[model samples]
Target chain A: MTFVAATGRAFLVLLEATGALAIFTASALSHSVRPPFYPRLILRQMVDIGYYSLPVVGLTALFTGMVLALQSYTGFARFQAEGAIATVVVLSVTRELGPVLGGLMVAGRIGAAMAAEIGTMRVTEQVDALTTLSTNPFKYLVAPRLIAGLTMLPLLVLVADVIGVFGGFLIGVYRLDFNPASYISRTWEYLEAVDVISGLVKAAVFGFLIALMGCYHGYRSRGGAQGVGTATTNSVVSASVLILVTNYLITGIFFSTK
Target chain B: MPDSTPSQPAATPKIRLRGVRKSFGPKHVLNGVDLDVGTGESLVIIGGSGTGKSVLLKCILGLLEPDGGRIEIDGEDTTHLRPRDRERVMRKFGMLFQGGALFDSLQVWENVAFGLIQGERMGRREAKDIALRKLAQVGLGKEVAELFPAELSGGMQKRVSLARSIATEPEIIFFDEPTTGLDPIMSDVINDLIVKCVRDLGATAVSITHDMASARKIADRIAMIHQGRIVWQGHASEIDRSGNAMVDQFVHGRADGPIQMEILHP
Candidate 1:
């Protein structure tokens, strides 16, 4: 096929696959609402996919928060407005950087593994075995992951916000010689409930997107080793893109001038 | 030869397929295929690579929707069923995949007890107890119960797969490539385990394997698939002389035959 034709075909496949994924995801959600919710399985998945992922998310948040503080202090120092470092750091962690950084870190860490593992299962007929055994593979596999992603991401973001803010305070107090108490006061001075809420909301959405992309790409994977590799790459790319796009939309919703 | 006394249902067949046709895109995988499995019978499906045997098993499991056919289990049409209803039907089946396909996150006991624990929702202690018993039945030590799939050797993994298959005591069992890559001794062990396991469950088995020794050891009847159709089928004892040219060529493992003539070479 010609390049244009091949590209068009691939795009069409993407659209069809996305539609199928949406349908499957909707089915899982519907099943989740009904009887026989697997609490033990959901808790295990939360511990695995969410709690175990904290160190990476925490480290990413810490560095990002510290770097934001340092950069903001320098930029504000040029205008003799260095005290604004506190506001910048607090806003950065609670508003934009915290959730985005946590999501990117998770996309790299958890998303790729989920895709590779589930894609291997797909190619290997394990999923079909589950079906033949009278188990809904979605309920057994996808639902728990989805529940973990949507529920535990917010909790991770909460921890990230606290550690991130502290990282900023550390940078301000030690590096820039700002008064510690004054930094805390300025950080809290202009903060609103909506700011924190929006970040948590983004975290939850990004978690859903990341897990969704991973499972969808994996479950749809074909062939063997090569197919799984392609699925993993697509998962990361799709999730990262969705995170950025959703970030813009969410930010615009919360802070856009009327 | 416990079941060799002659099955009453063998004359009438416990499972039947009629004109089962399936095509993936332009590639027709199963073309007008027909097969039958007797009650309490161990049937082996033998075919070369890319012969659509896997696809055939998937179709019977209702995992892949076939384009045209009638698949009847106990003389009931199971070809078309809603998802929920199909799940109810699936309770009767247990499958052993080529790779074992054990869930790596789950312990050996949990993996064996998956169908019972998740599908039937038996209590964990009871499930674990039963799981260990099944593992014991498969000759796996009780100490292997707590380890994850990644911790097991390849042979152990296959045994776990067998234990998991018989855990629910299914009416039908499907074994895909049961002894594909195992050593000769391990292959004999697995074949023996399969006999013990299926006989213990009284399951009507439909196993697809190219292993001739596995076929001879594990089957009461044998069917050979080629190019998506059953080229030959007969009692396992009669396989050495099925009076069909394709069966003769396939059994003798010959390169030059009607099969060679039929396959394309560009």
Candidate 2:
């Protein structure tokens, strides 16, 4: 690509991102302030998006943490720094991997599903029927997903944190032959409440991104079957990309050494 | 018999659209369209494929906002109602979707009761009772009520859609392509059911379709939409004397007429 063409493309992408962010901000504000709120709707979304999602998210987190420990043990053992294993696992989960990986997994699972469901509704005019029936599509459709996502992802990450730390614990206790008490103590010694809070904050933001991307693309989808499929693809891809990008930015804000 | 829809009181047009224009990029769908549907009247709008009949119906329903125009229902302007207000207006309507649009996650009874339970906030027991009653009105037995939409045949699904549309007993109902793809006999059966149920409720009916037979059987009056505008309209019998070439060509289903189909080749 030529310089000018690439620069123009980059600028266009930034503009698109800014527009999307603006829409997300507006909807979030609308959702929080809007009356006629349905507590039942929020609960239902929580059950659907959070409870039903537990098994898959659980499995992903358990394996990721175990693998992270195993990989770190091997890398640090070469430098005779294996005692730093707990520190490495805790920092990685708290700072980078937990929210990013959790968001990506849910993006693949929840984001694609949301887009497909909403996109199908859009195509079949169910969305219009909802509109005519005196229901806000944003409040009825988008809000539940956003609130569900904002809340559900944190719960998912909390589970991932436990299972992930446990996975590291199991590896350290059994395979690495590190003292279990020492490893546990090391994991908590320097772990401020800020670390856990930062991870959770990232989780909530990632959840919001997943739903925003999914709903925006799905609601705006045109054409027919092919269009729904494209919307689903875009939802997952954009959500996953945004999760990773936001993870870095958030990590810089929370844990920068200066 | 000009049976005034008693519910609307005949004081105002049930629906009015003035100079409504809609376009997608360069292709204009509705252009300076002006039309009115009388209270309690069954007005069937017939046009060929891509003639913007569906778009016009959607605009009236507030499903698609017209780029320029006013839409008033019962003398109250609805052209600029917010999402919530539009929904309130929508609650006054019932729609029989072209594809039935039943919720697959819900059972037949639940699909019918969706508006009652979800939109109207009716209790489940009452909603189901009303759903079953409406289902029976559409000739669907209670045995089919518990089944999901996927488990039913196309005819049964269409019947379920009809049942759902009338469940709330709204003042106005819109049917989009009521008999688009059903077999001839089945189509006639659905048409008859539509007439019977509509007359039973005394609801004002507006339907958009290309099915001349279906339109003839159900419409008390007929409006022919052509090129995003109403070309000729009159009583069902008067369609024969509309004298407008476009209306004649459409009623006769002729390819040779003032209307031209733009076939695009990529």
Candidate 3:
């Protein structure tokens, strides 16, 4: 009976958290579109979320592309299909690896930072101070982040896609001794618009979700240093999980053939 | 307990709370607190820690919604104002938080000018000038305005926070533990600055503190809260002779009294 009760209580907590998150998301989004928009704050967040994240995302894409090209060469060599390396590299990066890996990287970087910053504010009564100053915390804090995340993630992924495909090109020409022209040609020949578009769309969704989790956890954080630390961990963990889950769901929507 | 409300019977109190109650799940932080602060009156609430002092202040600030109560501001019921109306109501008030609560990301002057530039939509250059003036009002120099909150000492930060609170010239100001963690001399300095600032603006002031010195120095009227309710309130001069058991025990700082701390026995 105790075990049953514990399980029920756990479910209740999850249900309550989900409802709370839904309401928070709705409020943040609604506040984002309303009057009294802070373009300056949004621009600042854009720089933090987008500009600062470029190096890590770029390096991740470069290494992943290089490794992908070499690995694909090995696998396709078994079937005497070495020519398919370019197609596989470009398709995988644009369709799955680019958006998925970039989202996860950003979740670790920006999500944790957002949670820590806002959590500190929450614990120290800065959020309450904002309310007292006649400034809505949603508009001042959460909306700028939401706008930045939604707009910047797709841009990051777009850059990632280019860098990733180029990394594959480097490996194919320099290491694998393939004809550079033919490899480059094959990279684009099979790459349809849907593959890249679907990934960008996924990036947008992942970005918004990342910001939502960070802001929600940080805004609701209680206590002191310990509470802020917990919020930071929850922000990154929840964001990465949501990215993976939503990636699969969005891929199914875009690519599944019945 | 007799309250100071009788002294200001004719004017609507700047802030009035009747049976204000707040709780967090199993814990009842505020049972039913009733209090009043007269227009332009500096009222200081004194209480032991965890006796719902901060919670009571926050409920009035609308940061924490009370579970049940009637909160009135200038004779208007403000317990259930809509978001738009709440923002309008919030404009009339300013606060100096315990830790200063300065936005660490912004510069000292930016922190002071935040409400002016954001809430009132004042021009940045105009706001900056006012921010510097307010900083000077609190004994800070123009050079200090460019520095961040983290760079400032605790006393300087509190001064900057005071400047920020009065920058908008609010009609009412609230201070939460204005002297906690400060040295005795600095605490007294802050208490004096608070008194001067409130008097200069002719703003109603509500402050919560356990520091009796601060309460005495800054309050025209003093209220004592025990177990989530206001048990005694009168002129600040009469606090020492209140004769109430809780007030007597708390004012004298006696541990073995009617009010018990939840210390574990071996």
Candidate 4:
């Protein structure tokens, strides 16, 4: 009976969390469409989430690509398929590594920042002040962030994909003994449009999840400084996990064969 | 100084809360709160920390929903207002929060103009003009307007918050623990500014504070809350002579009385 009760409680907690997240997402998206849109706030958020996050995301993508190229050369050489290194590097970077790694990096940077900021605002009664001033916090705070996340992640991922492929190219030419021209051509040959598009779609979804989790946790935070810290941690963890889960689900949808 | 009686039978109260209840899980914050503030009256709710005074104010402001009760603003039921209606109703309100609650990202003038620009859709230039005027009214200099909230001193931040709250010229204003962390002299200064601002605008003011000096200075009527209920209410002058033990204990900051601090036993 105790075992059943514990399972039931766990299921209920999961259900409640999902329900709350769904409601928050719905409200935020609806507010984004509504009138009295705050263009300046949206632009500011775009810069914060997208532009400011570029260096970290770009660096992560570059390193990941380089390591992937080196690792693939080592493995494929054993199979007497060293020439396939460029194709492997490009395909893996575009299809999986670029979006996933970049999303995780941003989940750490932007997600934590958003949660900390909004949570501090929550504790300080700034959010309540916004309400009193006739501003719906969903519209004023959440919508701009959600919109920025949804739009900016794809752009970031696209850049990450290019940088990541470039990283692979440098490794294949300089580190490995592959001809630079043929290595570049090989990367282009196997790289279908679907590979890049699917990654970008996943990037967009990951972005939305990151922003949603941050705003949701932060907005609900209480108990002051400790609460803000907890919210920041929760936002990054939840966003990173959601990005991985959604990546698999999205990959299955785009690539699964009957 | 005319004492504004708590809801005269002849006039409709500007704000009214009856049997308002709020709780967080097992702990009941507001068991049942009942109060009324007359139009253009400055009503200060006096209570110790965690007595649901802030919760009561939030409920009335529609920032928190009451579990069970009716809240009426201007004789209209507002307990369960929709988001659109809530926003519409909120247009009539302005609030000065404890801890200043100034937007740290914005310049002092921008913080003051936030309501005007965002809420009323006023042009930036016009809002800036009003913001500068409001800042001046709060005794802050023109140079102070360009500085951010972090750059300002605590007193200056509070002054900026005051400017922001009144920027929209709201019909009703709320000051939540207006002098909680201020020095005695600064607290008195804030109390005076609040009194003057409320008087000049002829606006209905609701303030919650544990600061006796602030309550005495600003309140036309004072209500004391204990354990989520208003224990004693009367004109500010009557507070000293009110025979209620709870009110006496709280007003005098006494450790021994009907109201006992909940200290854990070893």
Candidate 5:
């Protein structure tokens, strides 16, 4: 009886949390489209989310691409197919690793920061202060973040795609003793416009999810320093997990065999 | 026992509450709070810690929704306004939170001008001019206006928050623990500034504080809350001899009283 009751209680809690998140997402999106928009705030958030995240995302993409080239060369050498290394590196980086890895890196950096900043504001009553001053908390805080994340992540991922492919090119030409022009030509041959576009679409969704999780957790956080800490941790964990899950779903939608 | 009847006549008090109730999942924070504050009056709520004084204030401010009862402001039923309507209604109010609650991200002048620019849609230059004047009224200088809230002392932050609250010349103002975390001199300074600002704006003021000195300094009438209910209320002059045990114990800060502390001994 106790086990069944506990299981039921846990299920109910999950349902409640999901419902709350859905409502919050609806409110945030509605407010973002409404008037009294804060262009200055949105611009500031864009700079923070997109410009600041470039270095980490760029570095991670570079290393991942380099490693992919070296590993693919080794594996394909066994099959006497070492010549396929450049195509493999370019396709894998553009199709999956670029958006996924960049999103995760940004989730750790920007998601955690947003949660911590807003959580501190909540604990200190700044959000209530906004309400008292006739400013909606959603418009002032969440909308800008949502707008920035939705628009900026795709741009970041686009840059990452370029950097990642370049890393692969460097390894294929210098380290593997491949013909530089041939490797470059091979990378472009297999790359379709759909590949980059799909990754960018995924980036946009991941960005929204990251911002939504951070804002939702921070906006409702209580207790104090401890609460803010918990919110920050939750923001990162939830964003990373959601990125991976949605990556698979989006990939299936884009490339599933009929 | 003292009567909870407001000093003002019953006809359309500036703010009125009847049986307003709010509760957490298992604990009732505000149980049937009834009170009134007349126009241009300074009414202070006094209570021990955890007696729902702040919760009652938040409910009246529409920051928290009551589970039951009505809250009327200027004879308008503001209990369940839509978000847009609520923002319209909120334009009449300005509040000083306990910790100053200034936007740490904004400069002191920008904090003061927030309502003017955002709420009223005033131009930046005009708002800045008004903000500087308001800051001066709070005894802060132009040099201080350019600095952030974090750089200011606690008293200065409170003053800046006060300036921000009154920048719009709101019809009603609320001060939550206006003198908490201040030295006696600073507390007295804040109390005096609150009095001056309220008088200048001729605004109806509602303040919640456990500090007896602060309550006496700024309040025209005083109400005491115990266990989420208003126990006794009367003119501030009659507080010392209200003949209500709860008010007496709280006012005198006595350890022995009908209201017992919920501390656990080690």
Candidate 6:
């Protein structure tokens, strides 16, 4: 009986959370299309979400690609398939590693900052002040963030894909003694447009999830400092998990065979 | 005289709340409160901590939805208004929050001009000029206009918040704990500024504070809330002579009275 009760409670919590997120998403999307658009606010968010995040996302992609190349060489050499390293590196980075890893890294950096800043505004009555001042908090705060995240993450993932493939190329040539020209040709030959396009689609979804989670948690935060801290942690954790889950689901849709 | 009777029917209330109720889970905060503020009247609500004064104000401000009841502004039923209608109604309001609640990211002038630019659709140059004048009204210099909220002291921040609230020359203003964390002198200074600002705007003002000095200085009439109900409300001068035990206890800062603090027993 207790097990049944606990399961029911968990299901109920999930349902409530889903409902809240759906409503928030609708509000954000609707407001983004409405007038009184704050171009300045949107541009500022773009800088915060997209430009400032370049170094961390770039480094993560570069290192992941390098390590992937080295590890694939070690394993494939045992199977007498060392020449497949370039194809594997390019495909994996463009289709999987680049968007997923970059999304997770950005979820940590930008998602957490959004939660902290918005949560502080919530606790301090600044949000309430916005309402009194005749500005819709959702339109003023959440819409710009959603717009920036929706547009910016794909750009970041595209850059990450290029940097990651470059990292793999350097490793294949310098460490594994592969001919640099053939390695480069093989990477380009196997890399279809679908691989890069699918990753970018996933990047867009991950971006939306990150911004939505941050704004949702922060807007609902109660108490004070402790609540803001909890919101920040929840934003990053939820966004990272959602990114991984959705990545798998999206991958299945793009690549699964009947 | 107390003037507790409803005003003449010809003069509609600037704000009217009838049987308004709000609750958070099982803890009922505002349980059917009824109050009215005449046009251009300054009404201050005084209560102990956690007595739902802020909740009451938020309900009227459209920041919180009441569980049940009607809130009328200038005889218009503002309860349960749609988003667009709510925004239309909110244009008449200005608020000075307890912690100042100034946007730390914006300079003081920008903070004052936020509503002017964002809500009124005024040009930046014109709004900044008006922001400067409002700052001057609050006794803040033009030098302070370029600084952020974090750079200013608490008193200065409060003054800046006061300036922002009055920047639009709103028809209604709400002050939430206008002197909570200030020293006595600063509190009195804020009280004086509030009184002057409300008078100068001829605005209907609703303020919630536990500061009796502030209440006395700014309020034409005062209401005391206990357990989500207005227990006693009268002219500010009649507060001491009202003969209500709860009002007396709260007004005199007494520990022993009908109103008991909930201290946990070991």
- By TM-score, how accurate is candidate 4? 0.97
Q: Which stretches of candidate 6 lie over 4 Å from their true place?
A: A1-4, B1-10
- Taking the candidates one at a time, how many backbone clashes does each contain? 0, 2, 0, 0, 0, 0
Return the clash pairs for model 6, or none.
none
lDDT tens digits, residues B1-266, model 6?
Answer: 12434445347788988999999999999989999998788899999999999999999998989999999999999987988889989999999998999998999999999999999999999999999999999899999999999999999999999999999999999999999999999999999899889889889899999989889999889999999999998888899999899999999999999998899869
lDDT per residue as tens, model 6, A72-145: 99899999998899999989999999999999999999999999999999999999888888888999999899
Lowest summed lDDT over 10 consecutive residues: which window, candidate 3 chain B?
B1-10
Q: For each model in turn, which proportion of the native inter-chain contacts is also found?
A: 0.79, 0.55, 0.87, 0.82, 0.87, 0.87
Candidate 2 error regions (>4 Å): A1-21, A32-35, A38-41, B1-11, B263-266
What are the per-residue Cα lDDT tens digits for candidate 1 across A9-108?
Answer: 9999999877897897898787766666778888987897688889998988889889989999779999999988889888889898889989988887
**lDDT per residue, candidate 5, B15-51, as tens digits?**
9899999999999999898888888889999998899
* lDDT (tens digit, per residue) of candidate 1 on B1-266: 23532234445566788899999989999998888787888989998888899999989989988899899887878899887779877988899999998987789999999999888989999999999999998899889999999998899999999999999999999999999888999999999999988887788898999889999999998889999998887779988988988878877899988777456679
Where is model 5 chain B poorest over a 10-residue stretch in terms of lDDT?
A: B1-10
| True lDDT of residue B106, candidate 2 | 75
**RMSD score of candidate 3 (Å):** 1.8
TM-score of chain B of each: 0.94, 0.94, 0.97, 0.98, 0.96, 0.97
Interface RMSD of each: 1.0, 1.8, 0.6, 0.7, 0.4, 0.5
With a 3 Å backbone cut-off (N, CA, C), the pairs that clash in candidate 3 are none
CA lDDT of A63 in candidate 1? 90
Top-scoring candidate (DockQ): 5
Show the colliding residue pairs in model 5. none
In candidate 2, what are the lDDT values of residues A1-258, reduced to their tens digit? 699999999999999878876886697559656865667777887887788878887787788778988999889999999988898888778666778888888899889998998899888777776665556678778888888899998988888888888888899999999999999999998778888899999999999899888888888788889999999999999998889889889889987984
Question: Each candidate: what lDDT?
Answer: 0.88, 0.85, 0.93, 0.91, 0.93, 0.92
What lDDT tens digits, residue by residue, belong to model 3 across residues A1-258? 999999999999999999999999899999999989999999999999899999999999999999999999999999999999999999999999999999999999999999999999999989988888889999999999999999999999999999999999999999999999999999989999999999999999999989998999999899999999999999999999999999999999998893
Worst lDDT 10-window in candidate 4 chain B: B1-10
